[model samples]
Target: MSTRTIQTSAYGGMNRKLRFNGKMKSREIIEWLREAKQERYYTILKFDEVILNSAIIAEVLDLLRISSRHGRVWERVSLEFCEGPVDLVVSSLVLMDCVRHLFLASDKIQDDLMDRLSTALRISTSLKSLWLLIPMTEVSATHLGSAMKYNRSIDKLSLSGSNWENSDDSDSDSDDDTNDGSKSLRPKLFGKQNAGNSPVENQMSPRDAAMSLALGLKYNDGIQSLDISCCDLPDEAMAPIIDGLVGHPYLEALNISRNRCRIQSVEALGRVVEDDDCLIRSLDLREQSPHDALEISPLSFALRQNRSLEALRISHNELVDSQVLELVDSFRGNASIKELDLEHNNITEKGIPDLTKYIKELPSLTKLLLGGNAIGEEGFNFLESLEDDDDSICTITEEDLRPAKPRSTKTAKTSKSTAAAAVSNNVSFLTGIAE
Candidate 1:
């Protein structure tokens, strides 16, 4: 006995949108296909991780073909933790004139199945978004990169959590929820080498995968948003990908968070932001390493010259007070950035004065997320006072407002003097930036 869920949404009394989830049976699928042929409704079908044989695949394909031949089309299809058989089903579905979005999550992808998927990607003209949250291999990465070079309809692509080195002997069974099925369950981003006959072929370094992807992205013109976070790509690998995205026509968002990108990657990213023709709006560098004053200098300098980037996220990257001050001073006359996320860093009362001054100067900055930091009471009070204005700051977390730990005498005296001046001068700062 299998459970199934079907949700329907009627739009403007014309066509219905139907979403089907859970493990479906053959008889039930046949009945649903018969009923769907008579109705005008779009379909979003999601398959649970069940043993899908050839018969199930044929019936599902027939159902999609019938719906597409009618006025109704399948909009999205998802397969969670399934294997090559499911991959073949979705690959066949992509060749249809339906399925704008496809999500496939698996523990392992064979070379033949990846070849089929890559062929479908190249031939599918209607697919808009493709997410392959699986343990990717070098062959699969090369195949997908080659496909993207010829693909023209895909707008959003995410290949996150492909840092898995080997898929052999790895268990795919899990009780975890697949709500946000893009990420993997692994704790570390490092790849593990497993013993095998073809050991070298079984291992796909994150950097190699990224380099293959860069080759494909270099020629792709239609991709708008790219997310390769959690892939453990260092500077050498990420530099090539950043070069591929240098002058993209429609690219607006890039998320490279949780990697090991160092000075070279940061400098390359700074060049991308500094380009006058750069149209990128959102840059997410969350949880990247070594964000001291020197490592962050390249980006800080680029921010002073960049006018296209709107949202910058550097959260949980171990930023200290001096780095925060450098960032604030860099954004003095910038007009584009609206959201700045500095949460979960080492910024405290010492950095709050410069932040307060910068906030007063940059009118475009509306939302500031400083939660998870030890900003202490003084920092909290100053930021809270600014909240009197509408839509000025995000809700400060309890950690941001909590009392600071005791500092050394000289540091405490300096922080206290800076904070008192900032607090007392808040009157003029508020007045000067008043509407």
Candidate 2:
């Protein structure tokens, strides 16, 4: 909109950089760069939801490209290609190493562009955050996997809106095993590479991409927050991600929701929760419903030992009343969990007794979500009772998250006077008895 819409201020940290965010034209951007003499600048410069064409994109990129080639640096700039000439966007960022935060989204994306972005990430040691909501298929996945090997600073990654239907023949609903059970239906990941060839010669499958990412994660310690939600990964691909959770200490948030994982793949998650080595605090396994408690047994058992998990979402898993009872029972000694989402399960009034028992005893539970089931009016009444019941010891975050206020000195003086008067009356009665 307005070329005068720029906001600027000084930010203090180890690196005291000037930060600015707003929409501006290419000419305005050039003006700001020319006026500013600082080496470190955090600029979020772009139009709001503007669907730009190739010419506009080229003009903007040309400005940025020319500035960078002339030794100008944008320390932490956030760039989003609204609608650009696919060809220019890649080249626009090639030597712009100062560009760290990136957000790319498009209806239709080209392969070479995807390859170029991957290549850029290989050298983006300054890149700390990247969100590719566009359909890059295996290209983004493999490059991201490979980046973990080289880049040390790029930690936050979001590959959301990835539909595995990147291929005309791609079907994620296929079974894990072939007819003889000796081979996997999905393409094998990283088979012994031919001596002179490379892994890129064959386009990486979704499974291979996942494995490559996870394999790189095994040796990596930089990535902490990973959101691979809705990235059409098959059951086989889901395995490496689970296995990658084995030894990572800095990984605090992991969301694998809506990936449609199988029992075998989820068993790996069980191992991760059970292992004391992994430091994941927030886990989202929603929509990957396990049929019975047996499917959830590993995590149920792991809960007894896990002290780091704070929020767990197992909603839409169709858990029976017995399963709910088992889940509550497993949380007996656990005090770290603040939110337990059991929404869309089969929990009913029959399981309310066990639920109430642990709700009072567990000492750390705050919010218990039990919506979306036929749990009936009776189950809700049970929850209502939990809220009103003063005897409930736990539910730490619910009613008694903070300590009681201290008694006033004036009240203490009043209590002392009242106690003296009662003692004097008692002495009179004792004196009469003595007489």
lDDT of 2 at 374: 71
Global lDDT for candidate 1?
0.64
How do the residues 158-196 of candidate 1 rate in per-residue lDDT, one tens digit apiece? 765444343324333232332333222112222223232
Lowest summed lDDT across 10 adjacent residues in model 2 is found at 404-413
lDDT of 2 by residue, 184-225 (tens): 111111112223422333554767667767876776677777
User: What TM-score would you give candidate 2 relative to the actual structure?
Assistant: 0.66
lDDT of each: 0.64, 0.54
TM-score of each: 0.77, 0.66
Clashes of each: 0, 0
